[model samples]
Target: MKIPVIGRRDDTADTPDHPATDPIEELRAQLRRVCGGRLRTLDAEREHLDARRRGEAARMRRVGE
Candidate 1:
């Protein structure tokens, strides 16, 4: 028999005061947390690449001059 794993505390029947927690909501929260870090890292990478591109362009111009 496969046991169902409930990811959120609100999914429990005992928590009447809380709205029923959706498994997808728990997943979305985790996804957002994980992707947030990835986004920051990508942003930093983009900035670095842009700066490198600019530096390369400047160097080429200097060489041409």
Candidate 2:
């Protein structure tokens, strides 16, 4: 299951109070990157999420801890 929406703590850095990239523009850019000329918002989101999951999993792995 996916995470629930929750308020962020002050220490978070991933998002600014106001993000520079417009969501629609970012999605369009991702679509263009993934597909040569077609729309692919789902593909973009999936790729982004998979990459983040991989990074987080690697970060959480126990390595001589």
TM-score of each: 0.40, 0.34
Error (Å) of candidate 2 at residue 46 is 0.2
Query: lDDT value for candidate 2?
Result: 0.59
Query: Each prediction's Cα lDDT score?
Result: 0.65, 0.59
Error of 1 at 65 (Å): 0.4
Q: At residue 54, give the lDDT of candidate 1.
A: 100
Residues 22-49, candidate 2, lDDT per residue (tens digit)?
4556567656766886664678979988
Q: What's the lDDT for candidate 1?
A: 0.65
Model 1, 1-65: lDDT tens digits are 22225563524435665455578765665566768834335789899899999999999999999
Please name the candidate that would achieve the greatest TM-score relative to the true structure: 1
Which parts of model 2 have CA positions greater than 4 angstroms off?
A: 1-40, 62-64
RMSD of 2: 16.7
